[model samples]
Target: MKINPLLVGLFLISPVFILLISYPGFSVVDSSEVFQVFKFTFHQALVSSLLATVFGALAGLSLSSIFDSKKYSFVESLYYAPSFVPVLFVVFSCLNIGNLWQISFKGFWGIVVIHVLINVGLVGALYSKILIHRLSLMNRLSLVQGLGVWRYLRKIVFAHTKKDLLFLFAVVFIFCFTSFSIPLIIGGVNSTTIELLIYEKLVVLGEVEQALSLALLQLLFLVFFLGLINFTQAKEKAITTSWNPFFKNKIFLLVPIFSFIVLFVGLWLSASFSLGWFTELALLPTLIKSLGLALFCGYSIFLFFQFIFSILPHSTFEFFMSVYSSPSTVLIGLALVVVSSVWWQGRWLVLLFGYVLLYVPVLFKMFVQNFLSSLKPALKVSRAMSANYWLRFKMITFPLSYSLCLFLGFLTAIWVLGDYALASLLLEADSTIALVAKNLLRSYRLDQASFVITIIIFCEFIIYLLYKGLAYVGGQKY
Candidate 1:
């Protein structure tokens, strides 16, 4: 696998450039204030995840009650829509309407609402599946005798779902905890998160040492949670190869899908004056940049997956614990590994590390990481005696990781496309599509911004389809 010169260059430039703008100095070290902020971010996320999970579970359970009805299928699609949209669009649409009504999307509570709204769909979707699985299991048991609804839930629902629920909570909590844009845009001084604060330390404070300190700290927190998750984690679920096809009966299910369409469409029409002017502008350059960053972001996921594939034996979660027990552990661990292996030093590695930090948890909570981690241990033992790098990877790593690398790569690519925070920090003035999207939005060209967003998402959908095709050929069986 020859490295792409452009990707290497971009990776090298993105993080290293931070050193130029970043302030390496700090006012007196307020370990106390930093600790307080740390405590607050976790506290808020815990509240947000718990409350949101309840709402999400209720929302998901509502779907279970509605299932087999023609209108029910639309429910999941509606729940999924917000999760797919860029957060900025949601914030803008909400703010546009709220302004007309003189309501505020500001401070802590507002941030929580947005977090819940964004994450509930994900939580709801997963819970719906969990509920559906429970229902199916109960159906199997009903052949012999009736289990009361409460008994069914206690024995089958809760009994079989310890790992799934643990996975969901871990996910929603980390997402809220590390969240950046929603909090940054609407948070003002009253709302903050570890991700936003890291941005502050790096971009605002210009404190490199402190920024790195904070980044290191954030990394440790994530690894800690990752470790806890692995402790409770169960065996990996095999990926379902069959796609559920949409049918005519599912047409009524479009109610929620249409509900979603109507909502966003209404927002678009109401904000037309803002969006109209944008639709007329030349977006070719910005389109190209968005595509470039998006492509590069996709490429980044593949490379990071390689790194993930590198440390297979001890669950990455377990390694995370061993590595983050001390900051020196991370510094030393990398030193003996990738950092010392090459001449490179700086933020590209950090940015790549950021992507790992970015994807691994969400993916872990989603169970993607766990699956990847599961395959590599046996593969690594095979590699220990292999004669060549490619031979070892091809025989042991890639084949074992066949389904994961492809799916995770594509899923993460879609994710990285919507990544505004990482793009904001790393991309040069005109290099990033997200920056361009934000530029358009900031410039009041809402329509063109929507166009750009649509195009980006369409590209992601297309890329994912392509990856799915390749996944079929791999014979690894997803």
Candidate 2:
């Protein structure tokens, strides 16, 4: 019998589908509370997105003024560093920083501050590249016209990138809205987000019905925003030049840069002072387990997506695959927990399997194009030689992108290591370093949590180096 590729793919996500079908519906009494959560989530997300975008735009413009185009790539990476670091660590760092100022980073303002810090760098880095490229096109004509900086910015810079600015706002809004770790950590009872609400329903209240309802609502909201936004934008190449239009106003750029430096310093001081954390035996085992889980999840997600993308034709079916990746991590974790009795053994395997399921969509979105490009030449060679399916896959397909596979594995592994939402639902207290650190943070053991976060950062750097090393050895540019 022949099988449809879409049907086969659907079977993989049958768990989520089952949960949607089995939902007991939303309760009338809970409507007001649910609406309150929704309101809070929307308000915080809106404020955070607006602030991050403005500040990021300023930082981007500042960086463009001070740095040559040749240094833009380095600048981009430096700014984007915070986003890639573990969310838990970032939250912990912010909390430590707040403590120094006698500030309470535990409510609406706290949530906003952390979200801005985490996302500002991303917006700045991405916008800087585009702004700098536009800088090269300015030349002396625009300058000779005596177009004042503010007037130039208003008429030229902002006008030209309005669409991108809107897109950036939507992107940041979505990220902050669905944010898990930051809100989960610092968001007290009054400021709980929908994502955290879902976790509470499932983990604390055991309200599967309510959890499912909340999950569906969050999913619908995200899909609406995501549909309105375009995911794919043409990436403009970086223009390498020595020209600087805003050289006189470089002072403004230092604010965001200095802010980031202060946050890092606070995190460093917290970690460095916790010298006794190094002697804990529990830390070692926790690290090893987290490492093992990360490796397993990463390679599994890499291979799983590689196979699925290869088999599925790039059509509407491929687009449908990314839907599963959009839902909250806590939602997916809860769904798996509900259904684990039927098909899962309640072991770490369930967590591993769930990670692969959710992570595939993410990896698919990231690596699908790369996979297709790599396969084209190999498939051509195989077809010319009249190779069989197995032979083509074994000899040509896999070999061409082996380095990419390893690199993706490394990337996903790092992400899994730092993730707290999914692991929160599935793993035991001492199962992973992130979990342990989060628990410590919850218990107000700041010193111990800081040390754990430090180790996690150290592990991430090592993994990144390995990814680069593999790419170099395989003759692939990362």
Can you write out model 2's per-residue Cα lDDT over 357-385, one digit (the tens) per residue? 66565555444533554466557777689
Every model's TM-score: 0.70, 0.80
At residue 386, what lDDT does model 2 achieve? 84
lDDT of residue 396 for candidate 1: 72
What is the lDDT, from 0 to 100, of the residue 89 in candidate 2? Answer: 76
TM-score of 2: 0.80
What global local distance difference test value does model 1 have? 0.58
lDDT, candidates in the order shown: 0.58, 0.71
Candidate number with greatest TM-score: 2
Considering every candidate listed, which one attains the maximal lDDT? 2
The residue pairs in collision within model 2 are none
Pairs in steric clash, model 1: 15-347, 23-206, 23-207, 23-208, 24-208, 74-253, 275-447, 290-433
